[model samples]
Target: MQSAGNGSEDEAQHYREGQEPPNPIAGITGDVPGTAVQAGAIYGGVHFHSHANDEGAVCQLPLAPAGFTDREGELGRLAQVHAEVGDTRQVRLVVLTGPGGVGKTALATRFLREAMAEFPDGQLYADLAGFAPEEAVEPDETLDAFLRALGVAPGEIPRGLAARSALFRQRTKGRRIAVLLDNALSAAQVRALLPGEGAHLVVVTSRLRLTGLVAHRPRFLDIGPLDAAAAVRLLNGLVAGHRATIGAGTFRDLARLGGNLPLALCAIAGRLVMRPDRSAERMVAELDDERRRLAVLSRHEERPVRAVFDVSYLSLPEEAARLYRLLGLHPGPDFDVRAAAALAGIDYLDAEEHLEYLVAASLLGERGDGRFAFHDLLRIHARERARDDEPAREREAALERLFDYYLRTAVAADLTLNPGRWHLNPMFEDARESPAVFEGRTSALDWLATELPTLRALVLLARDSGRNQAAWQLCEALWMLFSLRKHYGAWTATHQAGLAAAEDLDDPAAQARMLVALAGAHMNLGEVDTATELYRRAHELWVRAGHRLGQAAALENLGVADIVNQDPRSAIARFTAALRIFEEQGEARGVAIMDRRLGEAHRDAGEYDAAIGYLTRAVDYLTTTGDDYMASRALVGLAACYLQAGPLEVADTTLGQALRVSQRAGARMEVARVHQMLGELAQLRGHPRSSREHLQRALSSYTELGAPEAETVRQHLADLESDTGEEHPGEELS
Candidate 1:
């Protein structure tokens, strides 16, 4: 007998580490019950896959997945297989093979439910777990389970594989029974669990073909993707009347998009039908984004899409399998041999070979343009494997190489569009071979546009994966796209992610730099307070680090925030302080940028002379530095001062120069600003026709830029129409 021990730290530590003292009453089995005594073997690996029947004498087959479909014909065929045994002593065997999540187990379970009438003795079931993420079950372990189910005593069950197989056959001989072995990895596993001679039926399901099962001449069903009609029927059944309002064509589209797979359809259905308020259209709309399709399909934690695909993924060859996961680290949905090579850090031929192996395993799908993709479920599964199976350091290294690939490629592509900007390059310690190179500017732009979605996603990926440097650097490299193309949403999203990564790194310098970038994104988006807070944070970090240059930049960002808030006095103070730092550092470019900002502040405050003087000097400074983009911006400030100071000819000439320079430099937002200034200059001159034209042009450009400045342009256009006796373009002004 053992006495209770007080729960001290020492005793708790042992329990926490799972080394607690053994229970003293584990073997005390003298309690009496009001039922017949039944003793059964419960040896290693011997247990039920499901609950026993009400009588507790037999294990009941588990019900199939809800709304089972497309198996009516197969069930009838399976019944015939059992009938044709016709007095033969050999046990009837059937094998079902299909791709993962194509409902192989579901089909088997449904068949068993229907065939329970034929097996008078009992029905036994086991999930062989061949495709489990950890490892497949061994044949001997399965035999141990069968022995206990047959009422063999724990001590009497044989230890050797052959002896266990012999014992399993002997126990089931001449008995009418049903055995379902699901997710079998090989023929050996199936053969070991079969009875020697009996009116017994054994059914096996696996992803692999398991051709060795052919030696037994068992009945075979090769399941494939459900037909369109059957898939729709299955979806309709699962959605219950929630989809009744949706058209048959739309339902077909949903099923087709699900790749005519039962699991995919069911997963989406599970989400919609369960939520009474969520519409089928809304779910369809959510699945519209291919990048998010898998996430949408896996609506719940318990029924994750990755869980089904992990089994298939874990069953793959090591190289092919690892490549399958590494392929998920790819930035885009599909990839060619070169992209695969880049991802796996292998050569093209080797990548192709590995990819082909994945295709053979049904882990990858080949597409047009010599590219391949995972089923959306498989992609999610593969990524999950990359996170769970691969070590953190391993995934980090692979993603680093991928980042390097994306960075270098983006730089190379940028060079095609703006050759003068080629000098702007990311520093890789040892650059990998190019995944691809650009042929021309159009191709480069197309590739950039094509990769935009993933590039934005990778920014967050780098942040979440603890690669802080890569996160900020990738966003920095995307400055050209944000500045020129003005995908405001992507700009802010990536920068926000970069800021998070930088903060997590706890490096003041990196955090300050990210703060500046993110603040600029917020400024562009017209989020004045948010931008101000971000800049203030940067300023504090820079001050703490004593980085005068970074502090100056942060100060200037804050000045921009003040201007947005209509506080020109505060803006001037910030700009003056920033300009003093720039002057101390002898940074002419910084001085020019801050001086231009000061000029805008003065102009906003109605101080025309000060604005003109500051604007002219800044433009001269920027022009000498060959920064035409900044020069254009300064010239616009000068133009604005000229327009306000009763100098029509000079304002018109300065505006033309600003327009020409900004357009040439591809400074889209600046060009829009110049157009708005030109429109105002025209409006001052009473050229209503020209003013309307210029204002409309400015609005169009602002709209295309996705800049919040579009609202300002819209208001200006409204004023132009109201003053010129012209009705608003589309609607009555509020």
Candidate 2:
């Protein structure tokens, strides 16, 4: 859709003396000097809203624990703390500190649920996993998730902790939000997430008191074991049907044996509920004996929770028990049915059944998203059981299956998104099983985004476990996602590990791919020098390996680096070389892509005619191939050439087409680029108000994406304002 032109009759009269227009096209036929150029009347009707109103209430809190008991006094204390701090502009901070299995998380979850009405905007929750065997969740990772929940697109999210932290604060600044930071390791992690100048409530749970947060004046609530009466009530609720059979006195005995801890009490109750035929007296004796045995073995005071875990785990069916042990080796924070099936080497239905059984036993928690996770103490116990019961070979085999599953599934998703892209990984054939099927591009990208963190962990796990091939292959499979989402942190970390793994395996092709991928991240982040070095290294490797496609890809990357370095001549040369290889290989898509890049290089060098020829050919080929995303990009470049040359009307039309196509393809970044060029075109036509409108749209989109170009656009807007003085009536441009 095009907007109407504001050219007055006088302006049209001035154009009447114009010399012949630069290009020959359908709309223009000019001869006499200063004659009116008969470009068709500016078509106007389409209004595009690139950014939809998707930022609404984001409720990320998981379901509260069932049968929550006691803590009336603690709840009152929380209310009192909120009363003292909630009215302030600063974020209200509360720390629930206690030992593991002492119900700290349960307490926080319960309090937040009850206090939800005060935070109408929504709640955010994250498990820091401070005490888990794996690395603690980093603040940047949590911030990324939080920002996405708050409606920040993945590509729009900034890289690095500071930028992301600042963006998070900006997004949540005035929202009355509630945040629960579970199992936090340190005050630093908590501090990075504090919202800016809001009446937000932030609740943190940790085993340590987190005295480091004392400066924030956090209201520290130290949770302990539930009172005896409360523990009895919890047991009574969980094992209601069996309470009569267990008798009233036995409930107290069981609660005492469980140390009145919620986790232990739940486990004890799970055993009672599962075996309605068994008497509560017999269950208490079994738990007490296990506690004594563990105490002796540990050479410490009695471990009631571990004892309870042991009893519950021992009661599992053989298949369920095996699945539980194998799950301990899972590298991710949580897992779905498919992952569980892979880990246990069982079919999906069987794995689902086993997982449900584990949940019923209180050894696992349902995430309510077709996934499951274990409590910190329960996870530790499961790992211990796997170590003690399963053989080393069996454990390794289960892990291998998991790695294969992820690699194959990720490769499937990648191919779905970019089927024609060259790939070096053999996992597409070597890894067995049907990879996860995605319905389309949107679903494929969604899956990739959802599993990114787990996939990153798996890459490290594969590398550390000596599965070098799988490690590098996983990185290769993730290339599509990194390119689309621009998750720079994961992109850098995984590629580094993948590069190391390739080196260890002495695979030159794999190493080259990893280097090129890593370089792309640096290039996007504006580290052109670093990117150039990496691309050079990769090119050398590709040449040595005699991989023509790899060589071409590397050369193309070098061309991009050259452009970023402001060496258009060198970029042109590099693109020419890459184009030659693409033609030799008969790769039509690659050829078109190189042509697009060449057009950009020429445009930067002010060779507008050559740029237009290259860009038009690219646009034609890409459009014919139904590659709307690349076609939209080429159209933008073509319009930029038109804007620089003559025929501003043609530039406007081309931009309208580009905007429509980019929106159709969901290419937000390209859409922003088109808007930016449109803004410039409007300014050239003396439509100052229209220029500001387009420029503002560009700035907003660029800022959301955390692109460095945002600053340039902001400067452009500042200059426009300076030039125009104040807003005035002007024709709008589409």
Candidate 3:
């Protein structure tokens, strides 16, 4: 380790030498700089083609990309490939990938123009029309053109794919050349075009990853949105000789708001350059109003990013467009085709076709791994269009369908996870049918958690739609995931909305449920007094409605608030009261939960042995109830007692078990407590460095869950840093 660290420092010192000349290939010392025939070399040995044969149909490059806009990075990669094209022995295939209108073609053309000198024999360029108005160019057509370029008679090219590939490879085996396979359909199309055992470089630009070309080991380049600097540079380049009047900050704002997409930026710049009178600030303001920008900017027939999207949208079958809009409602950053289908209320195969159509129009992007995402700004754009174009009634209908989908699915998950638990009221409406039962609870929760944001939106939408029961039922169905995952922000907002709706509808049961959720959020935020008030009101409402279960939950929550307020005596009394009501109602899960709270209050009130006794019972009750997540919480509380009661080794062992249990059940909040206790133990043992690591991990978990304890732990970490004169590496534990 010492030697490795020293070597790393030595390398850093060497790099800091300002006088040293640049060396691109210095790492591979003792070899000739340019002697090796690199991967893309096209050796010249034979060309058996008829010079006079130019029949059959041939396609040229697609209109030179209409002054191809952005793609400096693609251009740079092509430049690198061109630099070593003369010496490369294997085929160097460069894949240019992105959402449409990101200028893949423009970059390819620019590369061909600049790198033409490297390939003396010729540059073979073809437009395969992956997203064309007509049928995609056939492989035979591409091969025939290539064979003709190799001086072979068009008739000599065979019709079979294998035969044509062989002839094409043989013809170009010995020649130094470059092939630009533009808008390819798949890896198969381009793989068939590769010259066998030769030096020719092939650049295959496609919208998809085309994973079939494993042998080529292609250098995959995902063309992400440009950074602010690159976007500005491209804008300046587009409006050549016309200086930008906007300040640097304003220009950057426009670029960011445009999502740094080359096509969008170029269009904005072109407008600015042409108008000359409109200030950049005015355009920025228009872009900031995301709801109307697409409609307003899409007035022009040409240069329509929005129009390109509309064309794709309008062409979609009614079902497909409906699915596309629902997809816009996805809460996660990206999702697969299956989720898209689920959102659209369709089959997987049908969804795949729609995804392909969207990709064709550059409305969505496919990652190398085949997952899809809309550009951040573009996604906001899609959502706006979706909301605007679809009628409000139709939109609400779709949202209801989605909301019920998640609610029903979550109920099924709850049953699968704990088959004996009391069932919440399923929506049971014809419009609220679940798509299908999942394979297991884990799979179900994964989907629900992934779709939580979208689900939350649906809950709010349902409440606004006056579907009061649907709104509250959705919240109850997802309570386990929401509380465990610590999605407090969404949880708090949804319940608040639900509470208002229930009050408007005069549903006491719904109101009680919403109040419990509201109190939990306040408790999680450290608003103890506010939480206590909400919990008390919820308890009263539940009693008025004669809801024993809701009353039990409210009492338990009040106990937690009292514990936070440092009134252990009050906490214990409240917890015991809740426990008796839960037991009387035969609520095993509720009794187990209250036992943990009661144990914690006892521990705080200096009853260590009694605390352990109650906690031990709590663990046993949770096991009996089969509530593994809550069971882990009891274990964590027990571990904390052991730590405070002076059995250091026992506490360490128990905390380890708690951590494992929490991790196995994906209880992030419980896991955070384990870290915090372990950290406190480490500090007691005088291992400040290790203590910091544990504390930092604890802080991250708490922060992620929006736990009330996060700030307390953060301050503790700060104190440690100040005392030890060592800055906290916050993410070191992870």
Candidate 4:
């Protein structure tokens, strides 16, 4: 008999699709539920009840709602819980917890009232007032109430809380009674009210999960946001006689706008019922404004929309409340543990615990990915609370910290995935406790994919917030985006926002950087002339700023645009001009990059000897600098030049080195390019089968990367099959 806590629900809100799911309590016992669970049939079971009468059962439970329709699942779970009572010596504990207005007390009333025959000794109910605006009902006072209901005369009831509880237990001993502790605050309060060693049942409904009850090994049912279909059914049932007066579309809008919160649904239905002349459309229209939706989602005479939220919010610990408020400030759909840590300015573990506590309080939802989010209405409510309660500077600081954390972490991921991109010097300090850590390039790319939308939104936000330097740097940080990822649209949009921010700051260097990045996006999109104009602007800005490296990089980009235009002569001229400055700067990486550019321009112009000379220099320089990933690319180009010169042996050796280096560096794109070169070389050397295999692997790699070259690789495989008289057209590369 370990004892004590307040209520239960939604520590883990969602689960994996099609997975039967682990014990939902996995996190409380070291299992986490950051990833939310979908709302559906939960903890399946059969419900059975006897039709026998309970002539003398003192049922003080509130009347089940007249409009009550679905809860068949919860009712069945209740019956299952009741059936398990005989298997144990102590009273069976069934605790129901979820968000306020989620209809906990009503569900208990519906279950206990129908299952009266299972508890012949008696059925008792008490509103413990745990989440009441005022102090909750005490355990002692509750025992007094139970004693009197158990036929104890007022004079015979004990004065002491412990004694009265003992008397109540003794009177109900070995009796198959059912006790409903509604609106309970803590397990300790209910612990004193549990029947001792009997086949009796004790059901608890609370706003917080009574985690303290874990010691007693109670069944915890986490009631999620009410199901949408079920909520519609509920609204339809509530206004049954008035259905013709309600619009079907209005009910849908109402259910969605309510976030399927049963309490809100009930309130909406109640409004329709109260105003028989009103249409569901009219009422839903009233509830449509997010800012005032909560206020309007109320019962005719009940406390307004935020009343339940107020009571629940006030009931939480101060730290938990602060976390809840600050978390709402994050402008993302959902956020991971690290972001939560930054939002609260707390340790990651501490932030997680705070999130758990808020979940327990039914304020936040945990998704399966270890991320925490809330229903939109709750989010809006939290934001309103933060604005009303917190100081302006505090809120702004928290937002800036969150912005800084995401920018710094995302930049780190970008560098990990695309190290060859030019890095911008951050003008602001990183506020994150720890930057994001990736296991390898694959994981870094995955993180970037997941955060893409959030980062774009933040760039726009940064620009709007007057954080011009941060906004532009954030855009420039993804400089390798056009080459590595297939996010051309996002590439253009983010840089556009950054360009505007750069103009806002009146910073010429920032403008130059933004222009070059935008030009890269256009160059990738095949708008060579547009790209040239942007790069020209960037080169001019760099010239005006006297930034030699910037000027060289801009010229190099212009050369890349010219290459895409199939004007290798222009590309060679630009690369040559850029090379003069690159060599003067004497950075091996920069010089190697220029060498690769010059080699590629020469290769495209069909000058194999010149390609070999420049490509081999790039290979040697990049290899000495430990830039094996880019070196692999240089080596592949050098191999292609060797292939063009009819030196199969040298080409084969170089291609093998490129393969190993790229594989070791986890540069799949470069590896794919190497395979493409190998396939062509093998085809020329009369290795038809070998050519097919290399082409197939290259196609698979290109397909996985969403690169357009997959189609070319496919055509190559088809051509190899055709010439060899081997038919595997769709079979090999499709």
Point to the candidate with the largest lDDT.
Answer: 2
Which of the numbered candidates is closest to the native, going by highest TM-score? 4
Model 3 RMSD vs true structure? 14.2
TM-score of 2: 0.60
Task: After superposing candidate 1 on the true structure, give the runs of residues whose Cα lies further than 4 Å from its correct spot.
Answer: 1-234, 237-263, 266-323, 331-339, 347-375, 384-396, 407-450, 621-624, 722-734
- Each candidate: how many clashes? 0, 10, 20, 25
Local distance difference test, candidate 3: 0.70
User: How well does each candidate superpose onto the true structure, as a TM-score?
Assistant: 0.55, 0.60, 0.73, 0.77
lDDT of 2 by residue, 460-545 (tens): 98889898999899999998787666778889999999999999999899999999999988887788899999999999999999
Segments of candidate 2 deviating more than 4 angstroms: 1-303, 427-436, 663-666, 679-706, 718-733
lDDT of each: 0.73, 0.78, 0.70, 0.75
Model 1, TM vs. native:
0.55
Per-residue accuracy of model 4 over 1-734 as CA lDDT, tens digit each: 11111111221111101111122221222222221111122232322212223347676767777877687888888888888888536778989998887788888888887888878778888888888435677566788788778776665554444445556776777778889998777666766677767898888998888876776678888777668788888888887886465566777888999888877877777777777876667667777787678778754637455887888888777888898888778877888889888977889899888889998888888888887788877887888788888889989989888887887777777666555545556422232234546666767667777777778888888888888877898887665444566577778898999999988887888888899889877765567789999999999998987888899999899898878878899999988888888789875578888899999999989998888899989998888877766787788778878888868889888888988988766667788988888888766766677778888889998888666778889987877767845543333211
- Candidate 2, residue 486: Cα displacement in angstroms equals 0.2
For 444-518, candidate 3 gives per-residue lDDT tens digits of 668778767766876787777788877787776677677678687888888888888888888787888888877
Full-model lDDT, candidate 2? 0.78
**Which residue window of length 10 is worst by lDDT in model 2?**
15-24
